[model samples]
Target chain A: MGNSFFTPLSWNDTGFILTGVLNTVTISLVAIIVGTLLGLAVGFIRAEANRFTNILLGGVLDALRSVPLIIQLILFSTYVGAIGHPLDPFVTGSIVLSLYSMAFMSEVFRGGFESVHHSMATAARSLGMSYWQTVAYIRLPIGLRAVFPSWLGVALSVIKDSALVSVIGYMELLRTSEQLISRTQQPLEILIGVGLFYFIVSYPLSLYGRYIERKMAI
Target chain B: MEYEFHWIIVFQKLPQLLNGAFVTLHVSVLSMLIGITIAVLLAIMKMSKARIVSLPATLWVEIARNTPALFQIYMAYFGLGAFGIHLSPYAAVLSALVFVNAGYLTETFRGGFQAIPKTQYSASKSLGMNSVQIYRYIILPQMFRRIYHPMTNQFVWSILMSSLGILVGMDELSGETQRLQSLSFRTLEFFIVAAVMYFLITKLVLFSAALIARRVFRGDL
Candidate 1:
């Protein structure tokens, strides 16, 4: 190990870094897609359900939100193994990360759904639209459009939080860089690269979110 | 799928784990305080008319907001080490959390400040109030009230992120849980308790924040 104590980062490590980036992107996509579907469903239910149902669903989502994602990942992986179902890190990471993202996404979705004025729904009903028709035609399109910024915000965070899956040993960018840092012992260069990669991915999306938010405000 | 429970072993080490929780709370709260201080300054600078003053502020805010918190902590702990500035794990985590906190809070504070109309400032001046008196009596209070919820969310985020302390071998709650679980081989039980503790900690913070907001905002929030 000491033989390469000061090895400079070389192109040889690019494939390693690329793998990490791909893993990070892959897991993030899975979580965001799965989480959005779940959150969309749960958020809609919460919006339409009775007060008691809302409370129950809200409490479960609250637990997901309140705990740190790392702990959830660790607890989840260990619990699953203890229960005699030892899955791979990627699978475990996806499950926990998706649920975690879903917690925040549901809130965004709920707010989006509720942001539509009661007047809009009444207007649709007066036009003789059915309940689902009013929802699909008016509320879904308008409310989802209204929440583009928030949805982007949560999705971007899930991308960032995907790094925590490394705790469960699914090597994403940060963890991949970590392994490289140990091998190369060039923490500064590797870490800056990792930070830059995340910044590159996140910054433009954030700008887009803001731009749309401004557009929608008008 | 049959598994025997070992919660008793975890319960036996509760005090040790609680101490770690205190450290987690301590680091995050301290980071939040320092972060808010730096963020306020950064916000002011970003809003300055001069490019020279605002450029660095903008860079700092953007980098902080865009990068992952895990990256920030590692950069603090290990990245700075490459420059021969060896810091303790606690110091590194604190500095990183403070950096990100300041970054995000700068935007929040800036937004809060902008939300206050310039007319309010001019009207206060017309009321014969000096700048300090106007800020103290009118502008500052309202600005804080506007940003209070966002600030609370930042605090909670900091709390949750401080769990990254485990990675660098800082004996925060997660790290301590990891150590204890390794020793006792009760990983699931220990982590489950830690999860509960985190849930409780965040809930307590939100609960008290609500109480404080109720009093501070006087039903406004």
Candidate 2:
């Protein structure tokens, strides 16, 4: 018993944990950026689309949101491999995560675009502004400005959901901590650290969101 | 594109998959019920002026809202196990779902409650209604009306999130699919069925929610 060694987390593991943190942040940032762009484009097109077009598009996007994301990730990862076109875990994870985020982002953006009151657009049109001019001059600015809180909300959720990407073998923070916990046999300390990391990153953003929302309400 | 489809194994596994779906539904409904009860109390506490009362409520909401549900599950499972207080995979996932639902719903309820006018409360008092009568007859109904849509959304979310159970070896729909695929070497077919099952469950829920909303709100919604 005296000669036996207990494996504990050493200082060397700091670098390992940091890599996981960085990977998580990088994947989330990529998905959020790509998703927001696609969402903005799709949402705007949908907002301007006729009823038939809107339904056709909304049905597809709604289906994306209906399924669980973990299932989507696993299916996509395995399906791609099953077919003749296998991809890297990072590549597959980002692609599925981005598409998932886009599904939600498009809804948030659609609501934002629609919140540009009809009367305001009519006023713009009455003043001899073209349709494109009104969209640019009035609708775009007001809608985008008003949706900062919700956009931030989606972005934060994306950050949290990024943890699920680890399932596909992309080593995120949770995945890294799981390894450490298993090696050290100390789950509580490691899990608390992970929770604290997320809380620290997320709490400030949510506070900012609330602050912006309160200011806008006035 | 060269992979051949073999769906026969998936067909034979249908009964097990359905059982998994039932477990998924049962857990999510249980979580939502517990979550709603806690949310209602937390919402009230959040609005209270007492520091001790509001602080813990705020903390719970923030922690639940900010952390990943996956992390919460792990904490309940492995983290608690570290301390000699073990929870089953089902218990861990259920508790995690409830924690998140309550956090999000507290905010939703607060919004609903605040939407009721202050003048209405004073008016109710002048009309000879006590606090209990006022809340039971007036405030509660209006709050529920305002919160109904969001609550349905939360229910759908809980169902979706319960899929996280797969990670913890829980035999919910996703977990069951994982097991079936590993056995039959038919990952795509099994998961595709599971995905469709989830889609159906959520759609059924939304349809029923819509029907109930129409009846309860008398088409106002």
Against the native complex, each candidate's DockQ, computed on alpha carbons, is 0.89, 0.86
Q: After aligning candidate 2 to the native by TM-score, how far in Å is the CA of B129 from where it should be?
A: 2.0
Best by DockQ: 1
TM-score per prediction, in order, is 0.98, 0.97
Q: Tens digits of per-residue lDDT for model 1 on B94-168?
A: 999999999999999999999999999899999999999999999899999989999999999999999999899
State how far residue B182 of model 1 sits from its true place (Å). 0.9
Q: What is the TM-score of chain A alone in each candidate?
A: 0.96, 0.94
TM-score of the B chain in each candidate versus the native B chain: 0.98, 0.97
The TM-score that candidate 1 achieves is 0.98
Please give, for residues A158-212, the per-residue lDDT of candidate 1 as tens digits.
9999998999899899998999998778999999989999999999999999999
Q: Candidate 1, after superposition: displacement of residue A171 in Å?
A: 1.9
Off by over 4 Å in 2: A1-6, A125-130
For residues A1-218, could you state the per-residue lDDT of candidate 2 as single tens digits? 24334478789999999999999999999999999999998889888899999999999898889999999999999999999798988899999999999988888888889999999999999999999999999998999988889999999999999999999999999999999998888899999999999999999999999999999999
Worst 10 residues of 1 chain A by lDDT: A1-10
